[model samples]
Target: MIEHTALVVGGTSGIGLATARLLQQRGATVHVVGRTERKLDPELIPHWADGGDPAQIAAVVAKAGPIDWLVVSLSGGEGAGPIAGLDVATLRRAFDAKFWAHLTTVRAALPHLTPTGSITLIGAISARAAMPGTAGLAAINGAVEALVKPLAAELAPIRVNGVSPGLVDTPWWSGFPAEARAAYFAQMAERLPTRRVATAEDVAEVVALAATNPNLTATVIEADGGARLAALV
Candidate 1:
């Protein structure tokens, strides 16, 4: 029985798609929006819009009507680079795709969100891990994660949380040639305590918990396979 409705922006692929599928399986009516449309399960409703655009997001949220959960998993383009050579434009784009998009979605959906509903923001391990080459990404994701506590307090009764994922096997790495991507994943896996990269479904499980568990709020759950701890050590 579908007991709730979820709006998953960026839900066309990767962590977003996996989350949508998981929520559907758990009996929630799921509506997904992405910059582009992809073939998805018939049960998953699809919408197309640029997450960076507030108007587009507003339209989608309006169409979704009332929602019990709003999951923002939009990805900005690549922003990783050394501090000395980092591109300002890339950092801005990243913020637009992630931080601003998250805020805009929340704003547009606030009226439609159930008072006891939840909002889960998807971030990355780079935010908390002091990784040398990830300064740009770290700033972008850090800003997103920083919103959890304040939003949770201000939006009381309406939960707000975040999920920071480590390196995962998803299309987000498709830019790397197949062999190089494999080698990189292997190297990172060896460094992680888990000795393996997480699957999209693995992170989705954490997202599901954050979105559905009323007792949890003002929390930023790390699903990064201990990458932050390993980085500190």
Candidate 2:
């Protein structure tokens, strides 16, 4: 937890918010940006901006001043469904919201990043997992993970990494009714080696590691609860 300044896009809630709080706890000056406003700690400098908009992202970066860690953890529109019934428009929206937004933010923050800083992109286990319904998510998140290797090589000295998380008890599943969500977690928990789902804090710890560890680059750490390894049934 070396002292550093960090900017976390999509930090208003969920994994992004958790990461921001964890960094702040470790004594990093953290600034957060999201499309909507939310109550945040006084120490966390907050801004509102759409991650998909280059202009807005540039403005947020400019306001944050030079940053040592740039983390992109925004959620795109849902693209999970069987290919036979898939809507191409949903996949396109997912890319627009996540993949392009990640690139846009990185490009905007480059000028303001510290020479020896780091950038962490948050993808999902769907990228590498053979989960059948997640084809669209795989494409979107896989593209994000793909950026790590090449970007790390090109951005040497300035580290670049990614985090691919599996199912966590985050708000992302809020669309499900409480009873249903709980049932879903219980079912998945039984199949996972850890016998539990991940917490947002659990995933945040990995993001913090990816951002602060100078030794790690071109790495994509999986924070799933062995969801990838378990049978997808």
Candidate 3:
């Protein structure tokens, strides 16, 4: 039914789920891997595996068969407070989800990835700019960028890159009260040159590009609604 296969880690929701849908729409057989099973079309093979666990990742990859694309879109421990206030366990949890999980996924999927296959790592705009309560996220995202270049070189024909998105509309925001969400979006809208927050679909488009575009490798294509440029100006 599908022409290619893509394993979307963290694909049960948010940007990852959107990406899985997009890829499926484009004729790829997509396997959605996450901590929980969810309601999705039958074509999307749902597999339960916490990205933070290496063994789980290995098992998922084994079931997915040969992967033409791998997308890592996991997240953890948001709003853990300032660095000085964050306890050891919180920091470790954050790292386990974003940094180590990414490492494990890439390591496990590399063997099965096709020569021309590609990987798209999700990062945050906070990695480039400073934010008070997101120290762990920034640190891990920077590490992801650091890993991208070396991994790209090591993987050669298998491209490795990242997509750093600004505040996008996702379920993560649903936890906040309506007032808080509006204020947050308003503040970001004022600061960003584009004067609007990015949509998950906007970010997914870039991820799709990173996964299928042959010319790009070891690059962090930013889809942050011009936040980076605005900060400089």
Candidate 4:
């Protein structure tokens, strides 16, 4: 039996939170790191850190102790908009949050990772399929996946992989207009082979698989309910 401790960055909501709970159920001690210390179960150890801040991430990593698994699930700032209308500051903010935050986590945790430890970076289906107005997300997600292959080799026995997910019903969409959200889900449901968008549990299962499976490394699991396939047709 494999027993290890895991540090899940951005584990307070959506896929990250689900993955943390799943890992705990699988016999791993899981510590969650997020910006806020609220909304987590009492059993969960919360490290308040704005993932965009490298120093905060370093402090959290130091306190989390030796980690056997590190999952980076940081999200970008916002979705796509017309290129000309897009604010430069907004674009930079998104990159800092998702791309730079990921870099910070890896940099801080690389030394603390135990032998045979694994790092799972989260990506999105937009990395592969083109989505209107989602250029910023696509760019960052693609870059993260691109970094995985070489990093896996460099990290050696410590595995590094990525999971790219499609539309998972999460609370993040609450900020969107109701009609827009409904239309988005409707499109996803119609195109995806499963006739529905993915769920946090669906993504959590993939994350658990990446953490526990020994043979898989430098791999990017596409958890998009065949959305990529539909896109080809």
Candidate 3 whole-model C-alpha lDDT, 0 to 1: 0.85
Please give, for residues 1-233, the per-residue lDDT of candidate 3 as tens digits.
Answer: 53789999989888999999999989898998988768887778999998878788898898896998999998874535678887878777778888888888988887889888998899888797776677777887888777888889988889999999988989878888999999888887988888988888888999999998889999998898887777522
Off by over 4 Å in 1: 231-233
TM-score of model 2 relative to the true fold?
0.98
Give lDDT tens digits, candidate 1, residues 146-198. Answer: 99999999999999999999888998988889999998888888889998899
Counted clashes in each candidate structure: 0, 0, 0, 0
The model with the greater lDDT, 1 or 4, is: 1
Q: Compared to the true structure, candidate 1 yields what TM-score? A: 0.97
Q: Estimate each model's TM-score.
A: 0.97, 0.98, 0.93, 0.94
* Model 4 lDDT per residue over 47-145, tens place: 889877878888888888699989999985574666667787888888888888898889988888998899999988888887667777788788878
Question: Best to worst by lDDT, what's the order?
Answer: 2, 1, 4, 3
State each model's C-alpha RMSD to the native: 1.4, 1.2, 2.1, 1.8
lDDT of 2 by residue, 15-37 (tens): 99999999998899999999988
lDDT score at residue 151, model 3, on the 0-100 scale: 87
The regions of model 3 sitting more than 4 angstroms off are 231-233
Candidate 2: regions farther than 4 A off: 1-3
Model 4: weakest 10-residue lDDT segment is: 76-85
